[model samples]
Target chain A: MSAKLNATNTLRVTRIASVKTENQTTKTYTFKDARCAKAKPGQFLMLWIPQIDEIPLSIMNTEGNSVSVTVKAVGDATRHLHNMKQGETIGVRGPFGNHFTQNNGNVLLVGGGTGTAPLLFLAKQLATKTKRLSFIIGAKTKNELLFLNQLDPLCTEQPVAATEDGTYGLKCLATQPLETLLAEEGKEKFKMVYACGPEAMTRQVFNLTEKHGVQMEASLERLMRCGIGLCGSCMIGKYRVCKDGPVFNSQQLREVKDELGISKLGFDGNRIPL
Target chain B: MNSNPLSTRLAGLELRNPTALASGILGYSPESLQRIAEAGAGAVVTKSVGLTPRVGYPNPTVVQANCGIINAMGLPNPGIAEYASEIRYAKTVLTVPFIVSVYGYSAEEYAAVAKAAATAGADAVELNVSCPHVKETGSEIGQNPKLLTQVIRQVKAATSKPVIVKLSPNVTDIVEIAQAASAAGADALTAVNTVRAIAIDAETALPILSNTRGGLSGPAVKPIALRCVYDIYEKVKTPIIGCGGITTWKDAVEFILAGASAVQIGTALAQKNPAVFQTINRGITAYLKKKKYRSIKEIVGKAQRN
Candidate 1:
């Protein structure tokens, strides 16, 4: 009757090596983590902030012996995470999920809000693999645009930046350039499009990518618990986003299209309009 | 996959592997159940469904506790009338046995749902007598030996398929309840369900789950569940299907050595992914090879002799 589990399956403590402000509401925390470094670009790690709650944050970047996650203080846990100083430790559980499947060819990357974090990680992985890579990022205002400087060198060409207020790059939404790109090239110029953003923006990406017949994989954000597939909190249709994906290809996205822009299950387990 | 020495039988039901997807974890839809089978579950049990439609408990249904999780998801399901189609759909794709878990407020409702599931092509029926969060449904019917007999008797009479009663760990003496279900004609017994528990927010001093209290599962409840199985095996003749915090192959083997014919895996599926079934199965087979045991039959209840 007496048995012990792999202790590593539970929360492991890691020290915050550094913190850098990404914007007013978000900060990138670099932790001295070796266990979580193996996480793929599209996967997420469950960050347990003591006394708050555990929340899933996309893996922003990983360097030698350290992993970084960009947190937007939209909720209590995120706010507590953003306020943490160096030398403080937090619990980390995973880098769980199926990551973005790399493809060879010219690529288009789209990011919105804090959604840019995982895309930034993906771009870093795809930098050398693709023939040419470009980015189109959007935020409510210029200050909210994440990882612009970090993404600059990674892009094969100049990245397009968009903000609704025209405070940054283009005044139109990020989808405008994508619409124009697909309209101009008709899916021939870029081999695929990778996007991570709000549901509305990602839904638009799904529509435009489908119209253009170009391959697209979008990183989806869903309320998650237990990051493993069991909790059922992160279900988008039959796919448990935590297990099957936080990343879904155009084809897989279509299967769950009914729930994509329609609704999402909330923290209370009730279906709420997206 | 071909049968190996690790193949096990509970009553007349045979499993290619000793690991099954326990009720209430990824058992909702046909596609998810199909994927679980592909991941290597010998059998997959559908989530607990009642006679009528229930949305279960509201948000904050699940939360991570010390070493596992607490969930008060009040058995949310589309009524059996509609879920039967889902069972049929799952049957189309699943190569393994599909066990339907049913719950009701009375013996008649339990028997009705079991009959509906059997007619819908369920290979077997698992009586969910122990969801700790829901009221007058799971634990209420499970904890009483007399009431347990009535429910099991009616269900056994209603369906020709094998009936497996999932017992609760909240009772004082689980062996008494197990003996009653076996004496009443339950084909097999799922040794234990989640223990009653709750989690609180430190800052607010309020219970974390929306339902206030929920059932605790994962590694934390393993020892208690094992003890129940060990205790029940000595008194009951019916085979025991062990569940509760079985995360690894070693965990699964421990349950079998403690007297479980096959073990149902729930919480481990969350952390290790669906592929965990195959990983645990491989580990079990390797252990069998290492110990020179002929089969799982040789291992079941071996601890009782000791």
Candidate 2:
């Protein structure tokens, strides 16, 4: 159960143990990896799809000897991964970067799209520790709002849903309801606010956390070539998202305010506006 | 009477120590460079920048090997034009020397990138002609004495700052190439780059790295790199910056004794944190004290004398 096995920085081939469809563009692939299975929520693994490409994916859940990563078919590697069969094999390297700090008391989980995958894993772990856990899951439509059924039993209150097309609960962006949530709960009510989604949404959540003086931890995604921090593709300010973070606290977030949601390094190492 | 045992000069640029942050390792931006500088690297070299932006190769770019790490990053860069600002910003906060690593397909391109680097306020420009995986440039230009000479001369003429040529170890005769670079006016030479190597996944029956081939670095290449430094120092007059597989103070000392004026740290950073710089510097200082050497310069080529 030592996560150190996943931290070898070398490729280890593992066959897919199971696969679950999450949404239209996203699918959850489970593979048996003792090292990966022990990974703390918020940590990620670099999933290598043979000759196609090697990309970083969030650890969605770990049960028994298996670990799962929820991947959306957004790029070449992920698309290829979606087409992979249950018996197909892929290379993995990690459980890398830092993980979220589990805080007690009232906590809010905000997720957008496949970003909900990691949060769902976290919610399951935090269910027994926290006094109250509330989730705000957002997507373009009800079909895309992920992990609602999985989150139901774990959350003290029913998980809130927000869809842009009004096909679900709140007809607005994920962060739109955050202000009301933070205000209703009062500034001191929620001990920590954890979020993982698009940069824009994370940025809004960050701003809200700052305004309300609530502690926040967020997972950020970037073009990562080397999960060991050698490559500079995932850099934000001085922090390499692969090493210094994939999850960053409020203090660390403040240091990278300039590039957090504003810009990111592209595949060619050019800074592109987010 | 050098008051600091660790202080040394390489190609006319003053450094706090001899340990440098090698190119292609956390040197993509001014902030990362500044962070390493703050961590106590005597000098910092940026990831190689070219005339045009290059996305390099796809993933599976790096893998851990038996004794070292193999990488085929394909020379991904933001291009010198876009990276100039990063150099400019680094100059403002960095207290140590800042070297820009430049690469290109032709001599003219190398010169252009060096010129852009010079204009951007770089203290020196390290010619990255030794990268093994990329074609047309890197080892392609470095392996040939004539081509290497052309690159050195053009880059030397393009920039007033020191031009340090990084040589490929995969050559018929490294000494001849080092001599050629020296004759063409290279101010200093980085003795070696990653040795060309490959890793294959038995499960998939395919090469692990996207490029199929890559440059090997880390503890595995130290002996190879030390030999290059030792050989190049015997024939070349230019200062030698020993690179490849230098992880500890003992390793750094070995390079100095073999005639290296400085050493570059790359793969070691992957294993240890940036604090490795301070650790090495401390070890070097202690070694100097224990040996009763007044300055690290006295140890240069000490083994050669025997």
Candidate 3:
């Protein structure tokens, strides 16, 4: 609501390191924007070309202003955005929204599809701060799984990967490993939980963390136009998914209505309507 | 992007710059307007108000798909009496002039609201001649060039301050309406209101919007908005407040070059991160500084070297 705080006020192109495909529809952009390296967790920025439209992208991690955005070639803007190369200078607008809070105890991280990008950045932060951390990630099939191999080195135990097809880790759902880990380690093992993915899965992750009385924060997605509150396109329940969220802790999600497939979690930790 | 002072007279009101917040987005509440305008917008257009208070449509009132949004707000607004109070309230906060936007089914209604807005200390009155919700056959007063002329002229006659005529983009020929409006005493033109459209529920088999049809705006509609502004600017002498799908300063510059004296931000304002006028103005200033262009007037409509 305040004037846009520029996390990337002064930035220029670092270079496109490489591009990796995550599914027929999504691609991971590994580029360097010197401005993005200064961004904090939960903050996002606007990436755009001069003539093309501007679009908001959550900064994945910055190795000195050299940032990356994992994009899905869904439409003309993104399709064209993905085809660009390393040397091109795309404009950066933010490092916007609230950042994930830091905790020094045991933690759990989960994600699905390209939603992993933000959590991956959070994981990188957790890697240095937390005593023990575990991750659970999922994809529709093996091909959709991204960054898990990279995530392995950052955690105590490798991320428990899941795919709908038995092509990855548990061959069940990503939540399965969390419940197993909880049962074995006891509910009090982790002090906090962080997750991002589809509404259905984020809701499930919320329920589990809530039962353990563990604090959890999530990155939720909505149809956003302005990436600011003025457009009113990305409202969910009473809050603006663009302004108020895109990231919400368990306590914040409780205030939101469940209509958009995100009612409170069922007792067993599954999204009810879905 | 010329910086030689882009401020111009809209209905004789001096806009610090050429952009204004389009009607239907910013409400009469000064707090919201102040939050946005502080970012360096040219002006803020209060949401369209009328003789009677309107509650507007139900929730899910806004949604996004691909590059744009479909909104069927039904011009929900507080009646003039309450609206005037809010305008007075906002005036205390905003440094820029607050342009009042009002709509009605008939000429008398427009004039009455225009009078109320003037009494409320509104800087100017923008007569909304193009809301597509009138009767379905055509806009009640806006589509017919003669009726448009009559309505705008009456509104102008009613208000001492300048009167701007807002036109819909759905017409087979938009320029005709712009020309007619210009000739009828309109002081400025706000080109290209929403293009009427509808969404359907594949599951329930009903129109998605409660009002049955809504106006579409966003990145998808910029070209159409630009074309309308370009066409209207050439046909009329009135200043133009170009709107629709304008999210960046580059888009703003295009509207100016296409002959818009100023532009308004609609759906783009709803999202939180608008490097909008501040970023855009800076970008414009930089472009001007870089090119040694003297003023915005210098390059308006001067196409790039293709």
Candidate 4:
């Protein structure tokens, strides 16, 4: 029962732009739909896999009538999504919840692992606005890091890169470049910061932003059922992250303790309920 | 929306629409009554109430299946005495009529809940002779026409308000049970309750639900409910309140065409969208206007059989 929205139509896959196998367990899928105009950067879609259950995925790219989703085959639905081709049909609903907004300010965009997809979308949107964009991408190793080819085209300044081992740009973490960027500009040149990644990395981002006093927003992850605020499964503390937020302004999280986005978010920052 | 132009009054009560929410699914619990009534649902049914407080089963009163669901909530309630207060509170809050679903194991247990429901200002009472998992009662009383009629007559005798007997779906012939309920002066009949089912842990080979067996509801059981309603509509002279897996307005319209004036939606509220009331309401309004029917009355039981 919906407001005349057919689950089939509301959750249809109109176009599959590209199918890239990034790793053994993960793949990048680009889809375009007229209904995707409602989506924003931090908001997600509930990808319905028919007999299997639905899973939540952040929209990685949004252009004229299309949105892209990068899925990791960790579960049933995600596994099914990884197997689809460029012209296949899938069930997708929403572009649900609030988005990460960028005001007319200098921005620092940070990303990690496959969590880089949303940042890639955000970076292109930010680059068109102003050239003073700081982009940092990181992974555990050279191979584990993804989306380099996509990011190379979008970043005005060279995209900052790092890993735990000395296989890429820096040997520490993505936050290291951000810390250096803060030091070089007397920590005041960047007016805003945003990030999507593992909770640990996001926690570091939120902490650094708190220290720098920059306006910051971080995308959080939580397992969602009805994705529209009915099944009480995707709860983070008090708020239903699906309805209240998946992207929260860093300052607002000061009052929120151990929310689902920061606590239970799995790889790529989607909440996976066990 | 009476299907038969030649309608008979039950115990002197007239039913314009017989589709009512089964007791546990849509209850007059605080703000919920006003919400459901506003949703344009035909009517509201209160959760089952007994003589004392019951905690019911925990954690897994409900389980999911490929088609529907199975739930074994052990008639959890705040008992008749406390429920009377809740019923009073509900009446003041609800704009539409409220039906109280009362359950019991013995003759006096049933009578007590009925008396409490009457005094609490409920518009009517549905004698719940069937709940699959609750031991010592429920379907045991429902499947037997003798017990079914007796329960209806006793509850009807206890209150001046309309009395409806809710029958079990897990029965040989639901029509016989419906006729018996009608003959006993029941004002209406609620066609069915959830069928009993259980799930296993697979690895452990142990029952999954705490109650071992639960009542099935949702889109999965829509067919069974449809069949039950169609079967009973053929024999019952009294109004029939059709329930079971009614989550959409399309489902509601189907029940109406099959000879029910209204419907009750459950399980859908849990797994699909909680904004179910709005969806069902919009669909009903759209269908009504599109079909050019002045009222639900014009199209009820309009299905033609070959």
Candidate 5:
């Protein structure tokens, strides 16, 4: 492994280069680090806020030697991260875990909540390789839908949005339109379907893709401590979310079907319903 | 006939090879253990399970230093009650010996977890009285020979399966503890858990691991671990399972020569993946052929003899 890859296990200190407010609860922080900058879409970084806590965030974007992580102020670590200003130093460990496989042909992207972070990065990367690209984002409200402006320019088809309260393009769950899209487009029309969201949403999308016999890959979230494969916190069935994948394909999902959306490991390592 | 030169026996359990997966490294679930077993480990050990559920410390729990990795995971587990099902599942799929590493705050708790592990179908139980970072349980108990002996005796009485005690390198005299464990009915001993250590960040001026102090594992601790194995081997009749910083077949062979009946691999798994088992096994097999030894048993403690 190169030094950059080896740095995945070693923590590197970097100052926040820039910050962008994505929504009321979410902000994207950019930092100058070669190891993280080299991250492929669907991989994540373990960000450490000194004296506070370390949390895993999806790689939102990368520009040159700079990489960005989108954070939603859900827990203590993220709330602290939200209050920090630019130039504040934090520790980074990865660009760890596997990334989504980019394939040629028409593709569909489904994202919900902060899960859209990695999918947005994937969408941007897939723009050039795919002949036709479509994006679907869902959130509790219109303001919560992420990266509308950025995704619009790259998508070959008009992006779709679903708000639980019907405050946006569609008043249904993100998977609703995805079901229609996959049904109308037919399995042969779309080469692959990619999803990153709440486990339930991704699991729903997986079922849809399976019903249609289309290949799918979805990024999952679990209580993670060691971003490397060592910790079993991220284990889902036979796979460790940190190593085997934060992103898993159709076959991988099938193997973990019983636990995919129904249950996940809590911080205590006990199986708790998702 | 079992003619493989690498085959060895530890505590009456037959192992296809001398390499067993050390506890606390991807041994959480049955599937992960099965994955390691399929990758060619002679035996697989589970992460240390306690009497109750423990969330462990927060992130910054593990970091890679210049020579090795340091971690203070705070003994995370789903509790033995929940983990028993995983053990039951592991027994169904695993072809190699499955050992459950158990820990507790007291002798009764350790015995309780060991009994549960036995009921869950574990081939053996490795007492984890040696975790360096945890307070009041791990090294705290292991550092005291009296306490360590009490814990071992309780666990040994609770289960019929072979009991292996993992020793702490942080102690003043490992041989005393080794002897204590052997006297208390420990069938085997894993000489040396990670050396107690820590890392600090220059920029923040704070410890990198959430717990201020952790244990060090990798190539840096190999010499120290080998010394412990050698020292304990001289005084104790119990079989020794050498662990700490074993990265190559040479390292495994050195531990064997130093009197380790078998070896455990942990930190190296982070760098090498599961293939390290096959790599080390192959190297040991080649070395045995070159040295004209018919089996690994013949070479155990060869260096000690000299």
Candidate 6:
């Protein structure tokens, strides 16, 4: 007997409407889905590329009936996704994960590499709500710094741009500019620090936020399957990165901080040093 | 479909429906467990807790294959002492029966955890004898009938609550173990845990799970689980909680017909939210109405006589 029926988690085939090449290794693909347009900042969608296997992608930007996902061609699945042509079909499964907590007052937004995808969306949302906002964008080089042009108009002051090679704004890590910014203005200037990036950078952001006593929320990355919290692959300690957070407040981050940047469990459940 | 005929009894525990939150899937915390109950599970089982806190295996703890997921979480849980508060908190919020699933290296340790759970207001204690990932415990204990019996007896002696011995599917004859648990005074039996299995990366020429091996659960193991329940039904009289790859209401029905009094859902919850319990319950209720059965008990084991 055919057991096939409409189930909640079934992947819906969506047409890729457009694609934007962000940098050398990163590209953002836009797909037509009304559900995603309403998705909160920091929520992710599981994209299926047929035989390549399903993987979670953060909603980079959304407008009208289209949602965009910034893909970094690092793994086999992502490499295959990068090669796909626009208008070709793919499966979209979510808008999953707990979103960043939005509040009033100034907020420091930091992002590095492709991790800038969700933070860019958060910045856009917070720009309308917060009294002030500043962005700290980081990458290995200026070419890899993401979303600075888009973030420029939304910030009260110039967004801090940092690249390892000194090709852009600051000649240091993303957190370095924030360290100076926080020290100059004091912790009360920025109500919270929001970050998503390399684990090492996120760890640094966490430490700076803690030292300054400023609240912080960070998006964590892990190998995940079944993004709704069933598969335990995306867990850091007791928390499921996909469920408890893709974005975690400082308090939540502190609980699982022991396992955070120290190591990440591989797809085979082996600990890989971060 | 809504004459309220879905309520049923498993051994002595009353259930509003046959659907339960199976152990090891989203049972890590009381908040999550309470949420699952709010979503419509008849009962909830906590993740198996041992005597001491365990970090469990490193990642790739759970991996998806074509048919199901292979997880070697190694039964990671806070020790009973620490998890007791979670149990108490969960009990205060839960309207459904709270079944604490416990595991340990020895019968004495199992009894200690079960006692703590019972004191913390667990409606039942599910002795996790069949978890395939953990060594010297789980299936290692469950695969041996004598050891399984000792563990069950110890837990039973320690708690006034119902004792459900969860069985392993890796055994040559699950019936032998089931009968032994039944004779040893197990109030009920969760017919199967994940089957011992492995997944490998064809590209990397390596095993996919961090532990290299894990137990498989999902739509793939339903047939095996059904056969297990059917076999145990023929040889043992204890109420069976069939739990392997039961993803739909129809799958739940098949287990009931095979003599499972209730079904525990795990892997399916990964695909969807806790709402699957209510969806399955509604579907089961509709099926019962369509079949002209007044209650699920009327259909339980109906296919076995033939």
How accurate locally, in lDDT, is each candidate? 0.85, 0.90, 0.71, 0.69, 0.90, 0.83
lDDT of 3 by residue, B1-306 (tens): 433466666667777776677776644556557756777878888777778766555433433444666666666665787677767877777888788888776788888988988887888888877776545212557778988887887888887888888888988898998888888888888878888877654433445445667778877899999999988767677778888888777888888888887888877765534446676677766776677777776767666232
**Each candidate: RMSD:** 5.4, 1.9, 13.1, 10.7, 1.7, 8.4
In model 1, the Cα lDDT at residue B172 comes to 90
Residue by residue across A82-175, what tens digits does model 3's lDDT show? 7777665455545656678877898888888877888888888889988888888888899888788779998987778999898867687777
Candidate 4 residue-wise lDDT at B133: 88
lDDT of 1 by residue, A106-154 (tens): 8999999999999999999999899889899999999998889989999
lDDT of 3: 0.71
- The estimated TM-scores of all candidates read 0.76, 0.97, 0.57, 0.55, 0.97, 0.68
Flag regions of model 6 displaced more than 4 Å: A1-117, A120-157, A160-228, A231-274, B1-3
Q: Flag the better candidate by DockQ, 2 or 6.
A: 2
The DockQ of each candidate is 0.19, 0.56, 0.06, 0.04, 0.60, 0.13
User: Which CAPRI tier for candidate 6?
Assistant: incorrect
* Model 3 chain A worst lDDT run, 10 consecutive residues: A263-272
Worst 10 residues of 5 chain A by lDDT: A1-10
Q: lDDT tens string, model 1, B1-306?
A: 334887877767878888899998874677788888888999999888878877665445666677877888778777898788878888888898899999999999999999999999999999999989888889999999889999999999999999999999999999999989999999999979999998776544567666789998989999999999999998888999999999889999999989999999998876677888999999998999899987888899988864
Write the residue-wise lDDT of candidate 6 on A3-24 in tens digits: 2211223345677788889888
**TM-score of model 4 relative to the true fold?**
0.55
Cα deviation in Å at residue A53, candidate 6? 19
Enumerate residue pairs that collide in model 2. none
Decide which is better by TM-score, 1 or 3.
1
The RMSD (Cα, Å) of candidate 6 is 8.4
- For DockQ, the strongest prediction is 5
* Model 5 residue B21 CA deviation in Å: 0.8
Model 4 CAPRI rating: incorrect
lDDT, residue A55, candidate 1: 79
Once model 2 is optimally superposed onto the true structure by TM-score, how far is the C-alpha of residue A87 displaced, in angstroms?
A: 0.6
After superposition, which runs of candidate 3 have C-alpha atoms over 4 Å from their true positions? A1-274, B1-4, B134-138, B271-274, B303-306
Candidate 4: list runs displaced more than 4 Å.
A1-274, B1-20, B26-28, B272-274, B304-306
